[model samples]
Target: MSLLRQLWIMVITITLLAFAGSFAVSMLTARNYLEQQLYVQSADNAAALALSMSQQSKDDATAQLMVTALFDSGHFELVRYTDVAGRVVVERANHAMPEGVPVWFMRLFPIHVGAGQAEVSDGWHQAGRVTVLAHSRYAYLSLWAGAFRLLIWILAAGLLAGIVMQLLFRWVRRPIVQMVDQAEAISERRFITITEPRVIELRQVVRAMNTMVARVKTMFAEQAARIEALRSEANRDPLTQLANRNFFMGRLAQALENEEFAPSGCLLLLRIRDLAGINRRLGRERADQFLQFVAGKLASLSADRHDWLLARLNGADFGLLAPGLSADEAPAFARELLENLAELRRIEITDESDLGTFGIAAYRHGDALSTVLTRADQALAQAEETSNAVVLLSDSDTQATLVAHDWHTLLTGALTGEDFLVASFPVLDRNDRLLHRELMLRLCQPDGRLLTAGAFMPHASRLGLMPVLDLETVRLGLVELGRVSYPLAINLSSTSIADSGFVDRLVSLLRQHRDQAGRLWFEVNEFGFRDELRALAAFGERVRPYGCKIGIEHFGRHFGSIPQLYDLQLDYLKIDGSFIQGIDEHPGNQQLIKAIVGIAEGNDMLTIAEGVHDDGEWLVLAELGVQGWTGPAATGRLQG
Candidate 1:
């Protein structure tokens, strides 16, 4: 039971016990007083009547009359007049009993009193003894009345006392409840402290709890500082602070799947005009400022639509996915965004301040991502011909995009048809030594044409077939691990990690391939990592005995859940490609990368660079304490 309940019970018990004790004593006292009064009345009446009889004549008639008169008074239970010679002259007795009082009550508390006896006298001579017994029925009525009133009063007092005590205890123990809540919050990764209570003992406990919360907050601050750099490096474009390609694409993919954001949605593509030439004429700093300016305008345009997905796709390209807007509304949205970008001329730039062009594509729910992008690209190309106008593209072939349950059918067939293939990319260490092979997934169409994961994984995810697809990849990866002597790294999707059945199958697979377990490593993206780290950790524990490594890709994309990362059994973190694309010149990225490297070093974890394409980026990564690298640079090293 809770402390409050237990205390209340104890209090009630004590209150009842005290009332019972007091009530018992009062009842006995009242019963004793009534018995004494009854005895005194009997004795006094007998003595007085004896004296009165003595003053009367001693004749039989007179004595009988006197006895009859005394008995008729009803004050005495019995009255008797007898001769002094021990002869019965006149005798009278009463057979009266106390009434209205329970027999059990009288039996439980029997009242004992001495009966009255006195001798009568006749002119200085002893005549006969006179005895009297007073009635006790009135005493029984008084006792019953007093007991009923006493019980009612005592019960009322007990109920009132109990209620008052319950409220008082709850108030006094309020601090304890707050302490419990604080502890629960801490367990949930939220550090909340409570104010000290007035009670001395409770105040001390609250102080201790508050002290612990403060310490945890400080620890979280130090850890968050580390994740903050990684988060910014991954989630945002370095120059614009807008969502990067991968994050935006994830959101866009989600929007495409949901009817709330599809069927009546539009995709707007903004391509900066003459970005390369502008960089040459206005210098690198001015060119970046112009891009930042353009990004700011795009940010403002989508600010009101919190669900809108906006991203810096590449150097001169940006994409926005806005749902809940009709196809006819696309022109208005594009015009507003284009006009906002045209504000570049207001920034005192030379030459043509044409800003950028807008490309819009509208599609229904379940439209393939490729079709949307293709339409948007075509519109963008057409818009480029018109200088600064917006271009809209309508799908020429609606049958091209798979909708309804088509993706499920396709994914299931692909799994069973053995149309899935695994491709390995090299992960090179700082010394250019091969650390592992990152396995990439590919699905082939019935026409025998190969398709990259970028082509169909979105559909697979939307259809909730990622577990099947991901498991197939792991299965193929295990086979590949046996075929090769090196470890193979595989990516896991959020859906797979969230599925208990998938975890079970994965555990069974790892156990079956115990000999090759060390050769297989699993990776989850930032989205997957954030979505189901606990599940991942549980799975990790289940597979840890098999000697496997689990890491996160695109580690810096989101860090709001970084506090939970401490609980996750992650082996390494791969910095996102956005930060790696041009690391050498981007001083901001270099500094953030350095901080991330420090965090990794402190945690005894490895840090790897993704999408390293040049020696400049490689050198910068080497200087930033990055241990491994992948992408074109690693591929080139492997080829060499």
Candidate 2:
């Protein structure tokens, strides 16, 4: 039982005991007072009646008349007159029960009094003794009235006391309930604190809990900082603070192969014109400073573009990977970079107006890395030969030149026709047990060809049609879940989650399909999630009651934000494919994956490796404590 209930019981018991004690004491005191008054009245009446009888005639008729008169007038139970030889001369008696009082009351608190007796005297001679007894009916009535009034007063006081105690209990219960919620949050790896109550004991407990939460947050921050540093050391260029060549190449390959990435994009390469000659003219220190200046300018230019990857390819070469950039936009993007580079010449850092040359190559999905590099190199050669600041090269046959209007029209038609397909990919645990199937959405074209999300999602986002598309995907997922026995996970765009209307509709849909809600998982890419944490948290709160789970996909790219996840209470983290590829041979990636697994486990989140291509990668991820994985290897396992 709850403490509040126990306290209520104790209060009731004490109240009852007090009422009993007061009732017993007051009734007994009233009884004693009534008895003494009755005895006094009986004695006085007896003496007075005897004196009057003695003063009058002592005959039987006179004595009888006087005794009868005294018994009738003085409210006496009995009146008697006796001769000097102890013979009764006359007697009068009346017997009647008390009225207007309960029998039980009388039995519990019956009144008792003794009869009074006195001698009659005439001229100093003792006459026959006269005895009289007073009636107790009036006394019983008075005692019953007083007892009833006492009970009424006691009941009113007890009720008032009960109300006061209830209010006090509620006031104390509020803080206790908050503390309990805080403890539960901590157990779930979501550290939270409660306000200290006015109660000294409870206040101390809350203070201790808050202190512990703060300490744990600090520890998590330190660990996240360490992991972020490790990631930087392995993937970042030391001088430019941009991604190194190896990391850039890995990410480019991932983008090319991953179905979730855009089908085609542009790659730009910038090279310093004669770095050796600049080093001879200017000191090595000055030339290094110039390179740093150029890198800073590039970083600043691409700061707003989260999808763009900037990297230092070599000593005097920098590469920028802009996914989803169309061939039409390639010239403007190159011109912008050239303008930024022109700052070096305008500032007189380099005398030559042409401080660098740019080579731009537009690539399609499934294109070889070496082939793309050779294309960019040919563009660079053309720029160097033609004395132009920028040159663009593209394979028109492979790359589809879809304009923004065409994308908008296609996506709108697809949405209207409900031409969307969901493809399920299995995620398996170490023991080859299925955890859940990740759902990928595909758009069906007029020609009966299927297009992956990467092909049209960027356009959908630009057209502000993500909410409708995402909602339709969720509706499809719910329908699919009704047919399958296992769980299904669908990715939601950050833009869709940020829309209040979309979240409300999604939550309403989940409420309608309550049975399938528990088996549904929603994931947002880490890049999008980092910017929309507040919106994501609100969405989680709205759907958490229905047992829906929220997770982050491609998680390792934002290792610095790990500490911020304490409040999210996420269900899982899918490490980015860039870190998972060739993990068996890369010790640096192995340590990074291990640290990620440790942090996720500490927060009670499941870690799943994305893009596990081969058995070697799978074995390494399993040994590194990854709970689940999905990619070619996982698909092959399901097939086998």
Candidate 3:
């Protein structure tokens, strides 16, 4: 319990104890006073009665009547006039002393008073001895009332005091609560301080806390400065002052939270396509100069001065957060960013060579910092695989135009107007056998043309609509599967992997079709798996009971961080299209394909090569041990 609560309990206990003590004392005093009053009244009545009887003539009826009257006037338990022979002449009795007070109370604090006796005489002759009994009823009643009144007064005082104490305590604790809150915020790395209280003790405490906070804040500032310096030393290419992996993520996280520094932006994460070969061909120092030159060129061309943050995310990998640019503007910016690097040096390795394995991804507000970075990394893989100068996330006008269009209204319309549709492309084995059909989404527009994801994905991504879209797609796919089951594989975007609602909806959709769920396969992008590994692991466990298989698409692109299959429970991997597109002549491509196939086979996961075009490339991949294929050359229903 808190100190304030303990103090409150103590105060209440003391108040109750004091009230109890006062009540006991009041009751005892009242009882004693009443007993004395009764005894005195009884004794006075007996004496007066005897005197009156003596004054009357002997054997007179009047004297007897006066004595009888005196006895009657005394409200006693019993009153009797007796002769010398002990024969009762006159008698008065009230109901046998009614039990007026509680026995327990009387026992707890018994009050005793001596009975009074008095001698009575008339002129010469002595009157018959008189005895009187006193009833304690009136005394008991008076004492009870007085004691009750005292108790009422004590109770009233206690109530008033309690209210005052409560107000005082609240007043006293208010500053403490504020201080505690300030401390909690500080713990969360938010710098804050509270005003000092007026109370000397509390003021001193607050002052100390403020001093401590100031010191810690200073330390944090120093540490941050040190970290910035170290990052510049350890990770920066030195010439460009661009970050490596260690610095990029920290800077990105800060940018995401800081509105003033980075209002809205995108990151262009790129890699030097083949730095080793460049270093070998052009002496070490020249290659180093080339890298610096490329870095500078990228920095110069990447973003405008308005609000974009560009940096090297890691070795050969670059990132840019271009704030305030819509998806439509990013691809153009990306092309510029990549083309500038090509001007760094003449390509001696090949006359038709590009400068870098430059993957350029664009991010708007509300994108997870980690997700954007991972996606940029994924784009870099594709760039390396495809040998594309730059692969802009917004190159496709579908995503860009949809992003430019009002998405809230469109999504609402699509959801309400039944404009959502799902289509599947078969993931087939080498001999043209269906391994499973990968489900893809298309939005039926008002104009009636089926719109592929490339049409609306960027908008969905920017609007934070991926999770909702993915969930609805799952529901719709389940419905479709019930009608026609063909080993369904549903695609989940990176956003859906970490969303609880998406997982829940998927579970519900599966449960509704329990019998067919076994044939279901859920596919997540490699970038999504890499970004949210924990969420992926949890998602795998959540869906495992349904017997649905989980697979990764665009796999082998992120070559560095291959997650343990034991941890992922993945059933298949779709090798990125870049690796499959032009694989016949490139020995390096053949070697990489062999490594990927070996990794898949070793892990007990089936491998599918996407974007297989020609027979020579297909034959090479088949020889390299790729099990499945999907591309233009593959005889399948593929919408362009």
Task: Output the number of the lDDT-best candidate.
Answer: 2
Worst lDDT 10-window in candidate 1: 254-263
* Model 2 TM-score relative to the real fold: 0.91
RMSD of each: 11.5, 3.0, 14.6
Error of 2 at 33 (Å): 2.4
What C-alpha lDDT does candidate 3 achieve relative to the native structure? 0.66
lDDT per residue as tens, model 2, 343-393 = 898897776677778898888888988888899889887877654378889
Over 1-640, each residue of candidate 3 has an lDDT whose tens digit, in order, gives: 9776776687778778888898887777777777777778777877777766666665637645765676566467655666555565666666443355665655665545444444444566454566677765555556656766887887778777777888888998899898888777555444567899988999999998889878866654554344334334543546566544543454455445422232344566667776777777777777767767666776677433423446665455666655545555666766766665555545442222566665656664346766776777777777777654566564222223433457778876898887898877677787777777777778887878866664466567778888888887877877877788578888888788788988888888788889888888888877678778888878988997999888887664332335544446568888766456556865655766676676566457788887666677789999989998876556433332
Instruction: Kindly provide the TM-score of model 3 when superposed on the true structure, using C-alpha atoms.
Output: 0.44
Report the candidate with higher TM-score, 2 versus 3: 2
- lDDT of each structure? 0.77, 0.86, 0.66
The stretch of ten residues in a row with the least summed lDDT in candidate 2 is 556-565
Model 2 stretches with alpha carbons more than 4 Å out: 51-69, 274-292, 345-353, 381-388, 397-400, 432-434, 479-486, 508-519, 542-547, 558-560, 636-640
Kindly report which residue stretches of model 1 are placed more than 4 angstroms away from their true locations once superposed. 1-9, 51-129, 135-178, 192-348, 351-442, 448-450, 458-553, 558-640
Which of candidates 1 and 3 is the stronger one according to TM-score? 1
Number of the predicted model whose TM-score against the real structure is largest: 2
